[model samples]
Target: MRAADRFSFNHATAKFWDQREAVEACARAGVGIGLWREPVQEMGLEASAKLVQDAGVAVTSLCRGGFFTDPTPAAIDDNRRAIDEAAALGAPALVLVSGGIPAGGTIDGAREGVQEALSVLAPYAGERGVTLAIEPLHPMFASDRCVVTTIGEALDLAAPFPAEQVGVVVDTYHIWWDPQVWQGIARAGREGRIASFQFADWVTPLPAGVLTGRGQLGDGCIDFKRYLAEVDAAGFTGPIEVELFNDALWARPGAEVLAETKAAFERVVS
Candidate 1:
């Protein structure tokens, strides 16, 4: 199955892991990877690109490139650079975590900023063969994270572009709680907007900033098999990237964490 064949490790899962070691670990584990921007920048984009390419691992998506709600010229320029980096790294999609409400700004206004930013970047992304995967973060992050909180909202934002240019990322941690999740998945498939499918189990009493509180595959309320069924049924045959941001996972040995995560994913999804 394409979905099963495309399992990936989101670098955020083991953030403390060294960049080179993480890529090597992913290759050793026989999985693809969703690369983060900071580490890539730190390692120097060319060096990071060469390492991943030399490892022969697929770079599913670039961790992020949006947050242009303020839409300053500087922000747009940065996004453009991200698009180029994604292309250089052979990443098919660039995940966009649309910035949260700017100071004193309403959520509605922040969303408008996302729309505007998308309009600016979508074309450039299209030209570079990089899809912009708008990730609708969980509502818990509506205040300080992403403004797009539902698959439906992401689709609406993506409606203006061809599926190849603009699309949505289905992360279970963010959308599992939505009552309308199934419908959203169906819509994404029907509209040809499922650019990336990510996974992260949901846990309660979210951490302070709600950034590093993701649950492991079998440790939370999410039903991985069911999500797999839904996305598969919706015809989304892409990499199922596990993107847990748990502090505990980050504290462990990278190889151990990767092995555990892969096993948990297989156990839950089977």
Candidate 2:
């Protein structure tokens, strides 16, 4: 299939889309979907799994399972549940957001905590055939959202485990600004560590809190074509999920946003 043929709509792109409807839309488009935890739980895990299975919708990746900056027993248990959910949903990867610096803790300490948590969970995830995809959020999110902010750093964390057990998320919005991004992607490919590939353009004048300001494809300065080319060259033949966390898009109807997003994706990638 062509790279665009592997397009998967990330549920976060249309934050409010009904889960069943989103699966139907993806089915209609003949594409896959990247799901999130909350909606999956809301619909009941078995029901959600059934929804996607019955629709014949591929589950690209699950939106998150790691917040082990503190590495509490409860936190690790929750992540284990996430892994089980991913396996049940037939998702090959579980996106992990290695949470921010803990309160009264240093960034270094947080990083250490993430490693510790992963060391414990990676084996568990591997046994269930789930890859813990470590997502490196943008630098701006480092202080409070994710301590892992670069592909290289994420890879280092993943290195301790087998690539099948631990890998990294190559989200354009998160890594576009890193000068070492291309190198990182290449390295990820060579190491067999690309667990997920996500797309989100970077726009200027980021909104307050800077969480919901992701740009639609081709609406900003990200060179998506270059990203595609680079990842393709690196042997990353996988679904490219478009995940935009945009306030404006969320304000509109989910169908409208999906239509627009599909058009934008075609325009940029075609």
Candidate 3:
């Protein structure tokens, strides 16, 4: 298939994009999409499901269902709801942004908490035919964002579960800084756990929150072809989701961003 055939626009890339508008754009372009929980819920569970179904857009994966480090029963319950939402949207994978360090907790402790969360939620997801995709954020966000910061760490977290039930998301912006990214991709492929592949460029002078500073494709130094070759060598053939969380992108119209994002993806991956 062509590189564009695998292109999926993650709605979070354009943070304020309307859910209906995003879905329609992806469908019109014959592209797949990754959705977030809030907007999906805002549209009402069944309504959102019908919207995607009617739009004929494929839901590549759900944006989140983690943060189990909170040690609250509500966390697992929310994940269960997320899994249900994914099922309703016919999404095969539910992305988990395993949250940051807990209060009075060490990194190791937080990791253990993630493992515990999975042990409870994995089987539930499995029963629902949804794979739990653990997305490792950049290490810079380790303290306040995701505790899982590398593909290797994500794979380690996925080790105890069946690959069919748990897998890792490989996004360039998050792992491009890691020296062992290729090794991790190989390992994920060997283990049959390469669940989701995404792209975003890393730029310096990160903004205050460090959340919305992602650079446009060609604006930053990420080596996209290298990542593509490595993952392909590792045997992953799946949707390539482009997720750019940037203030500039979010400020523009969603349709314009989608068009620009698709062009950037073609420039880099085609």
Give per-model TM-scores.
0.96, 0.98, 0.97
Task: Sort the predicted structures by TM-score, highest score first.
Answer: 2, 3, 1
lDDT of 1 by residue, 1-270 (tens): 644566799888889889899999889888999998899999999999999999999999998998877889999999999999999999999999998889988988988999999888899999999999999988878888788999999999999989999999999999998999999999999988998998888777667746888888888889888889998888877788999888888889988988888888788776
RMSD of each: 1.3, 0.8, 1.1
Which predicted model would earn the best TM-score?
Answer: 2
Better of 2 and 3 by lDDT: 2
Judging by lDDT against the true structure, name the best candidate.
Answer: 2
Candidate that beats the other on lDDT, 1 or 3, i.e. the better one: 3
Pairwise lDDT winner, candidates 1 and 2: 2
For residues 31-116, what per-residue lDDT tens digits would candidate 2 score against the true structure? 89999999999999999999999999999999889889999999999999999999999999999999998889999999999999
Off by over 4 Å in 3: none
Ranking according to lDDT, highest score first: 2, 3, 1
